[model samples]
Target: MSTEKEENQVKSKKRVSDHGEVFTNKREVNAMLDLVKQETERVDSRFLEPACGTGNFLVEILERKLIVVEARYKKSQLEYERNAITAISSIYGVDILEDNVIACRDRLLGIFTKYYINHYKKGFNEQFLKSTQFILSKNIIWGDALTMKTIYGMPITFSEWSAVNGSMLKRRDFQLDKLLENLEFDNSEINLFSDNKEPVFIPQPVAEFPLTHFLKIGEYE
Candidate 1:
């Protein structure tokens, strides 16, 4: 094997032993992502990568979603920016390694910013850029998935961002555990006394930050 290959293998083995980290090759990453190609292309579709090591999956998903945004909204700058930010906010990831979390955030943001600049010759909007970065900071979390807690030991939470009423953005936060559990239902048994047929899991936002515009997210103290 080449010296670089050998070094990579050694590092991979060490990471696997230390943190169960096994980096997926690009081919395998695409093959896996292909299974959900349609969802990846949908700008508003929500995706969560439980062990997103440097965003192998999230990066590709964002790329696909951006393509759709560009095709549909390139003529309308404001429309495109709003949808693009929604797409970025839709992706969620959690990693035990702090480095992986930071790298993934930067990678995803870089992809979006690059696309934004290519389309907008006016360079880039500062407010839009900052707001997108803020969304990423919330979506890509550093934590242990098994424990469902953030690196700070607090319950991991995620914000669901939706573009509503044309220009307004609605933000709803939910705990990772509650969102995952979803109130298990027993389909085998039916309760006659209950007015509701099955247990409903309505996600309640622990906190919310609504924005009239993407730029407004920064203005909100």
Candidate 2:
């Protein structure tokens, strides 16, 4: 097959559906997104574009949020700018394709760096990239958006979320707050990282073949 076809296939593989071609049409999408933006309060809101193909949705969301924040908080440009950057941190996304994922991630971060560096004196954390990978990984993830599963290539169920996230609920010795104190989870202590609340990844089984359907369960009684 031709390079054009191959590229399209690779890109499409990451798309949410076969109709992804029409989804990239900016004029059409921006119109709908604009209508949606009208109903929501832009202040401190969080949104997730689970399948972030090329980040068109994210860009529009950011643009609309900036306008809203700037108009509402005219005097505190710093507040507006911070609100904008913080709003970006609120947006989360995932895409299966590496190229699309990285591209979307860079575009979002570029908007942030430009605004923070230009408008504020107390700019971004200098080691923002190195220190808080969430700045990179949190906003835009690289995985199947539908599954919300671990990198283990399996679909995460409510049970898994309960087990993983609930691990925190098990501890009572530290005042229900110290779990995040960096004393650590997953056999590692918080002292190693200096903070307990930060997230840690758990290891899981590898996939010999892509497991598309998730682990199904019956209704909870």
**Residue lDDT tens for model 1, 1-221:** 56998998897898899889977888898899899788778887778899999999899889999999999999989889889988898898999999999999999999999999998968468889888888888889999899999989999988777788776787778888876664655565332112235654545669977455777765654
lDDT per residue (tens digit) for residues 40-118 in model 2: 3454455666678668888767666666766775456535544554455446566766677788877776665565455
Clashes of each: 0, 9
Overall lDDT per candidate, in order of appearance: 0.83, 0.48
Q: Could you say which candidate leads in TM-score? A: 1
- Cα TM-score per model: 0.85, 0.53
The top-ranked prediction according to lDDT is 1
Q: Whole-model lDDT, candidate 1?
A: 0.83
Give candidate 1 regions above 4 Å deviation: 1-11, 182-200
